[model samples]
Target: MAMDSRRTHRESAVVVGGGISGLLAARELAMKGLRVTLVEKRSHLGGAVGAHEVDGHVLDSGAESFATRTSDVAELLTELGIEDKICSPYDGGSWLYLQDGAHPAPRTGILGIPGDLSDPSIREILSSAGLRRAKMDKLLPASVGANAKTLGELVRKRMGQQVVDRLVAPVTTGVQSTHPDEVEIESVIPGLQAALAQRGSLAAASASLRAASPAGSQVAGLVGGMNQLSEALVRDVLRRRVRILTGYDAIAVDRDPDRGGWTLLQRAPQLGERVAPVHGKYLVMATDAPTTLRILGSHLDASTIPQVKAGHEIALVTLAIEQPELDSRPRGTGLLVSDQVATVRAKALTHATAKWKWIAEEMGPGKHVVRLSYGRGNDHGPLREVSLYDDQLITLAMHDAGKLLGVSITRGNLLGADVVRWKGSLPTMRPGHREKVQQFRNSLQDLEGVTAVGAWLSGNGLAAVTADTRRTMHEFIDATSAD
Candidate 1:
């Protein structure tokens, strides 16, 4: 139970947190010929991008897909020899559930901001008045919403409040677990404002960004699941001789004055267990925003700590049911429910079997995989519905799924179900969040061998995290080489 007298003194890099970013950082450091030690608080390696089993099927408990905005994730997969495994989702396009009813979502859009207001699908979700106002974006100069901070403001100024409420709200709430109002425009969709300035319209900017994507869907997934990336990274890091410590939480960090590096005080999750300090030439705090700030707060000046907003507490309820009617894939990929739809408590639903061909083939006939997500960033009151018991949550998910899917799915048709909860896993990128992150990183310059990386620093999504972590690690490696 006592701390080990002998500390691990080595010329190494220490990565706290075993999420995708931490694993990638460790792998990069190890590949650069540096001894690395990865400490994970959880017993498992992957943090949000992890897997859970249900009815003999291994499903992604967290992120199942990665944004294709950049080739970073694909490149990493190729390095792991799984590039060929990258697969696109079904082309059936998702739907939007509004207060009125369900309608097809815009086919060519970025985060529910329709690139082409003329599209029939867009018209279906918007009223004649709403459409008229949205089309004004083309006539109104780019300067209209150019200075807008939040995505909601940008869309509202250029498009209409209808677009923000019916379209953008559903996507942002479903995808980011936060409303578009709180999401920083640039953080979620980079270069959008510049594109808006150049193209002279928000719709045109959305169209341009979509056109520039990798010639297919804006997102893609591994054939098995995104969790494979974590598995592959673990294997790669192990092969590179990286020492991995699971069930160990890095409670505090300090400068290793004698070693001229950093010292991490690690403790087992259990109350009375502690471990010897881990000393390394470099330290990467790759945990979530709160945990990272909590540990690094003591080391850094108070002014250096950014006031990061707390993330949403999300619960994903995945249901495996014997619904023969779902064979038709009625809802397309699934539906993003608008917050205005008081009938449904869920923010989104993914018809997994319909979206992924592999999942359908694996499940066979009359079987379907439906996932419903609960909780949003703006939920008020003390008792959240997602905090309910597993069985109760599953019942709610089934009822909500029935409403969203326009079908009658009951417990009689249920084969299996599981609920996965994530607290503060998805970071909320408020307006000026990027600037705050930059300032915090700038402050870290005073502390040698100390850096941070994660979704909190990088925007949400696997691509951003992968790209940002690799860049940070490379910079760290370059700095070390120079010294």
Candidate 2:
């Protein structure tokens, strides 16, 4: 019972926004035999993850590095044949800032969860009492079957407050730019808790989990700058026969009461002209939450716009300096700040040059590049500019971080060196986020053809979620085929 539903008429569709999501979507649609147009507000293709060369050094302005655990990203590279650009992370070691010294933080602990905390590496960082709590993992009765437990409640109950404060807090914040007490445990630490609850002891469960481990390094990166991946998407999508508009900003959408298709109105600053009206049977909104609301402002309902208003706030800045100074930041995988440590706004750090050799090569023979990220800007705003002279705030962080990384600064050159600032963009998982997104889904059903996807649908992290959206889009296209 083979079904032949391929439509001979190639319907033209437009993908709004040239970010990763939009670029990916355009590629997928064009591959399905549709004429696709990729539009971007900015002149460049890479959104958060972009790169530029200055003084013979290549600098990643937004996102600098990504972990290898993302299979979807890897697959995309393979599909684009850009796999050779990826370089493995240096096993140079990582350090953590604590009371007044730098200690090793676990990077290969299998998604921040380890099978045995009794290992010397883990023991070196935790106090005796902390170690005792970690050992107690074997004694605590695990849940047989039930809803997932929060990381705060579960880790503190099993691994003790120190481990949670010292370990999980920083790691989670770095990855999601979110604090622990607020982030959903099921969403962040998925699989660990559910499996722990089922096994009746986290230690036993971890041991069992480790047995099924894959044989390879846990964290890896591209051979060139991490931005190369984004560049490849931009490159390949164009070759797929899709028209890309970089300076065209979509300002509004209108319905032709007479025709059922959408009228996409765009403003191209570069051209200093208005975009010729594009009539399309299908429209896909892949811009971030806030931007999406503005573009769909006129066409969508008031109730519909509020859903886009709810978002996440993450303040991330990348500081590029000489190799020695860049080496001056936390080395290895970097440190994570514990929630219990007075304030909990900042999280983990990674050596950009050390992590991504390709980008590092651009730093010259002895120079280095690194990214400094801090979440919850409202809290860090007044304190982020902390000074070492008389300001206890900056002094406090400098003292803590310096000791952890084992360095003393003789000048201001090492502290901020050459910082690139990007204010926080808060990402929210409020009480009714899923519900609101569902409403957004329903609102579009009334329209003739529209598709939406990205981190807004699920959680952050690139490849996996994009894969999920592609699957859904394929299903949608199949069901709506006009054969």
Candidate 3:
């Protein structure tokens, strides 16, 4: 492919999403000397990584931490001059709410897969029969689950239905926002399948991955909150003179027929505002999969549009309460609930104060911040009804929090509360999603100036998005600069 010979002023790029990925993309392009423009439909810049205030104290309403599996997020923070503020979660362990009761989550595994089955805590969650079945993974043939596509199929073949339902399902739902049966093993845990083939067992493979992971905590957050990363990124991008447009929803995208660049059509923010055509030499689509595909599909082949499942709508309720009983942190950090647990409608609960010492210190003694997340995988069942109203959701959250934490949190104890609903913020990676995403990327080979980057293309979470966005932007920069 070659650039149009008659073109002029080709050193410009337009980013279509203002989340972390989009912000990072703009920063990279600006560093490469390309004037950049970023557009976000929401008035806010950080999509899921935004802040909210409760009782005069500011806190993160969505993601609070980033995985330390990779150094991308930390490296980015360091570049932005806020790495000193990075902090780790308190040593208190997390818990899992099972059908029988709450039990300590497995300490030495990825996504709830136990590395060492001999741990005494394993017995508390798995029955004697279940433990016996799980131990069979070591005895099973290495090829048993090696070819399985989904995480559920692989785990179920090597371990058992009990392990999949009780252990893996909850972790997947809580972390990836999808069932193990739906998510691809390659997408979630990249090296597990190959490690299984080499180590001869899922348990040993998990141990291998955990051993390879960075020491200290698997996740870390800023002293204030994860939202600070977004704030810092936005500040840096603007300092670089990147033009940011909020409340402008992109409706269509196509290659510029007149000049061989790219053109985007954004819907006006208000009734009286006029819609304008934004033109750039390069384009980056960082929105969710559906919206990204809808725009890109206009220029690509029909086969290139992946048949992906729409992301689930998640509602988070953060409560500020005065509970002395929770000061000791009985549940530690919070609990991930098994879908089979009939007592609660919320998928997971985060003891925000217990998880971060900074948050606890800011709130003073006896004050706590607890957040309950509603919605898991594709099913909404109880959550669909409860999430319809803020009061209904908050009331349910109070009851569920009390039950999960084993402490009383009542309206009388509640000092302040907030509810934030995120629709299509987190992608649900289905089976073969990894391959489909790769194919979608390949579909854009003809349009060398356009790139797609986000959680939908990269695997979910801050680590994946950060690392993938940098690589994507670098590739585009290298290719275009060569011209």
Candidate 4:
């Protein structure tokens, strides 16, 4: 029973990027029986989450794991029935690498926000004054609490600067490439904002956040790599016959000019000279921020996304080190970079096996795997300067991890390391980013089939992008499906 392709009323969707958001969007739309085509510029799918096996060790392009509290991702996994495939961070423990190397985080801190900086447990990372300021969180006004603000301001207002420079910056930057001075608190630390606005005090907020953190709790990831999730997602919908085009770069999306269905001109990555125009009833641009802006052209105006220059961000450099000495038995997850402190050297290291316990638990034996990652900030340029040589990275990682753990590292041996740098990671959502976000949102109404989705909305990291993508999909579905 072949279907006619010429049916005027045929339903279809073209997801312009093969990133996680794009994958999710395609899955959801395909499940609803809409003809779906996922177009990715990369020859390989899984935008930033690409994964491969190099010499029997799993290598990932981005964060090896994803946080689970955002039920949107969890719900999606459950719906796809791959919920069992993802594993959580080891509840037994996790470590945060500091200036020295690797050290156990305080058992009571909230997302690295100290429950009591005074507690001798974290005194090594804070001063006496800082500890006292931790108690002053109740005084800040709640109105601007959730508003865009720098991590420095957030801590200086609610806790203190010492805490900001030490634990928060070093750890949080592992996820965001910008510094505390640049990383919007609202974007990076959503818990703090919610605590201040909803719960009304820093202490109350800390308690609320502490309870939700992956620390000493189960965190999650796919078996091979985080990209496996994306692959699985794509595979699920493919059985339903969703069209997928890989290695094709969508150049521009606009009206056909002559006929009227939206047209997308794309050049396959390798076959660049072969540019072909694609048309669809509706188009979902699941591209990165810059490209989305480029495609918007005149369609971009005050009515849609803001004119503000999207903050330049840096892609991450992940080093997979097979060090038995530095690596513990697969138990918990890894560490992060405090963007401000990330110098010419290493950023931070979070244990992958530790972060996702399933990967570690199932290992045969004598295989101690760890993901040593460094985030080159937006401040750095040309990537080569920030890029790390295998030995150089190993040295810096050891220093950074040693600083956190407050110990010498003679144990783990170095496996191989790889680097993939995405120049435009996301916009830096400074305080007042929400206002810009409003402007960005308004810009979309004027565009017929284009919908922008990325971490740029939050201007900080990927977790927000996941939640926002879920919301954006609904918005697109509503807009495109309406009469």
Candidate 5:
């Protein structure tokens, strides 16, 4: 059913974003017997967690899996009735491509930080001198790098620069699209410092954390695709009668003093020269940091508005190839390329068919799917690559795929190819990002019935976003109920 032609009168909650976080928030509000309206600027609901069709095959365009460090995402999947579809990647471990060459990544590690420095693979990637420096992490006192702010700082102080450049840099750049120097140690690995303090060694702490996690792959995805999670959330929220307004952008927001609620000024092409006012007793700003600040800036004090760094512009090039050599899975699931490697432009590549059995089965024999990601946070050189024409990017991806996979792949072998670009979707969590987020959240306490949640605040990955959204919504529900 279409929304009413005029302004909505005082809904119990208004979620200004239709991403996963916003959808989950709307669902939570509706479940608590509150009328909710979900507004999204894009025509589609899911933000980064979306799907695209390439070569007659539907694939996840953004996030494809969730971390299993916590059961938060798994439990949510169970509630959504798709838990049975959860599947793991093949047992083939990933690889790392450094300036030297390609080598298998350490089997037991977190974010490329080897849990056991004695692992033979570590010797293959690091020089004898580098390995000697890394082993010093075990000898160093726990308090040596205790107060280090960034992950790069902590690792360099504990291990060495070689380890940071060759090991950690590839993983951080591949996964987060940001360098380790810009990543907060605590934000990415919670309780790591405390663990370091207790274990008296960084390597020991990493091993302990890895051991505590659920057995098998640290990440998992649905049999179909993670896009199903977004679709499922949309379906569930609609069943609860949550009003969903796509293409409706919340341009301005303010407090309704007389009504003791919130008012959002929304504009859309569909509205055509008219702005619609949406009123609600509660508000959830589930947008990216920049857009959220734009709408709520006037209402927040100048000092209270946190300075948020812009996210990187990422372009993913996916290729479906009919390469018989790929049947051997030369590089395992895929390889994370070090930024220092001048030979390859892509920071990472995932052998989709080799990584996911379902995808392999869908493609049948002799057909393979590979995805290459291009972009590094705050790096304009890579931004230029992502800004290239679709055909140009596809050609570049094909070259990079051939180099990384050790296979001769040409256009003749390429059955189909596509490029998907995402802007400001993967937020960069700088060294002090978590502290700034906390300060910003504290400032919102003065604004009654208003809260904020997203990757910018909760850190990256589906697990962090899902867990944080549910927890924040539950808290909001409790606070609103008490009043």
Candidate 6:
């Protein structure tokens, strides 16, 4: 081991980034008997799927659920021996807070797109004129918006602007952290284009997609928290004898001419820390888009590299309120605020205790945990108008929660509160994002023993990320083994 100071680590991998993807990549390499050294800039791992303690209860600080469109996350959980922990949120449903008032979210739909146009909730959200306009989607030619690049265009052209503005915009922005105009329809809603063509109508196509999807809740969570997946991944990778270095930021990457591998220059998060060099036969850049591109740009043509802009900066305020009124789940699981709602600054709110039965049982009676998310797809959202300090943000959360949920949650009722902010954690997959990522990956072909994988390449959600990371690892393994 000491001799590695002079020579490159032969038959080894150096994975930069300790997120779920990086950890999975390291595990895959380790399973193949390749020595793995994973480096993370943060002191703790898990990246966005992290955990925090609020009022003595440890909960997921980032992503709390995974889409059930695919079994990728479920399979991974099963592999990690946590299959029995899978649980769906209570079937109480969710709500959308608009300028007028709170309305029940449309059922039988995906991403707030109502598959059943006759749903009462859908009618309530759209005006009579708006509903008439939306009905024209059935009469319009399927080709009207079939080739539309953005989700906004497709929905607007076929289903009317009201559908896009009232229905799709809030859900898309809240979930993807980006505007529908910037989102690629194919990437976000796979097979939607073909479905539209086949069904000859937008509503029918949405219904077809929903029908084909796995029955039951569209999302699922672990018994403990979604962060358990990260914990399980770290444990499995460690068991595989993978080496993990925390608080180590990779500053530069270079191709080792002598060994025909790769070498990485790393530094600690703290200033004046000593620099360290790591080398391996295989290199995985699993950080955010900008950081990954920065490291790989050293070996590839900088001009051809796609510049992935920083995503929305989100600040989450979790409030542990002693409110018995929320026991009935006033707004169901929570509410997604519409952009037109000038009264509320928070974009979304999750009644944690109401959403997850396990959390409710853990907290006991008369106590509730509410989480409010402050941020929007665009930079000019309400979050920008408010200050982000812990006290200030919590004050805003308390105010918004009371209004959105139709309950009174004063500072006296606030038992415990904390603010968690994620900067550039979400990747904005705008139209043509897939192509740009492909071009970036292709640009790395000339550089041997290197590959990149993350949410930037895969679309949003745990399913896309988990599936893509494993697939990339297999590809890398096969390509290298062939050599």
Order of all candidates by lDDT, from best down to worst? 1, 5, 3, 6, 4, 2
Candidate 2 Cα outliers beyond 4 Å, as residue runs: 1-8, 107-111, 144-149, 204-216, 269-276, 293-330, 339-346, 359-366, 377-404, 408-426, 430-443
lDDT of each: 0.88, 0.61, 0.87, 0.62, 0.88, 0.86
Q: CA lDDT of 354 in candidate 6?
A: 91
Give the TM-scores of the predictions, in the order they appear: 0.96, 0.81, 0.96, 0.84, 0.96, 0.96
What lDDT is reached at residue 347 by model 6? 87
Candidate 6 weakest lDDT stretch, 10 residues: 1-10
lDDT of 3: 0.87
Q: How many angstroms is residue 419 displaced in model 6 relative to the true structure, after the best TM-score fit? A: 0.7
- Itemize residue pairs with steric clashes in candidate 1: none
Candidate 6's residue-wise lDDT over 113-182, tens digit each? 7788898888889999999998898899989997799999999899889988888888887777777888
Model 6's alpha-carbon lDDT is 0.86
How far is 62's C-alpha from truth in model 3 (Å)? 1.3
lDDT tens per residue, model 1, 37-144? 999988888789999987789999999998887899899999999899999998888899999989988878788988888898887788999999999999997799
Model 2, residue 53: what's the lDDT? 56
Per-residue lDDT of model 3, residues 166-188, tens digit only: 88999989877888998889888
lDDT score, candidate 3, position 449: 89
Taking the tens digit of each residue's C-alpha lDDT, what string does model 2 give over 1-483?
111226577777888878777888888888777888877877877566677654456566665545454476777788989887766666665655555445666644544455677667777777888888777877766752134345556667776777766766666655665555556564544477667767777665655555554323444566656678788888888788989877787877777678766778888777768566666667888777777767766666778655543443443334444436445344665565543445333454555666665666666554554444544412445444321122332334344444334454323533243333333233545435566777877776666677776666655555445565676577657755653
Task: Report, for all candidates in order, the number of backbone clashes.
Answer: 0, 24, 0, 43, 0, 0
Q: Say what the RMSD of model 2 is.
A: 4.8
lDDT of 5 at 19: 88
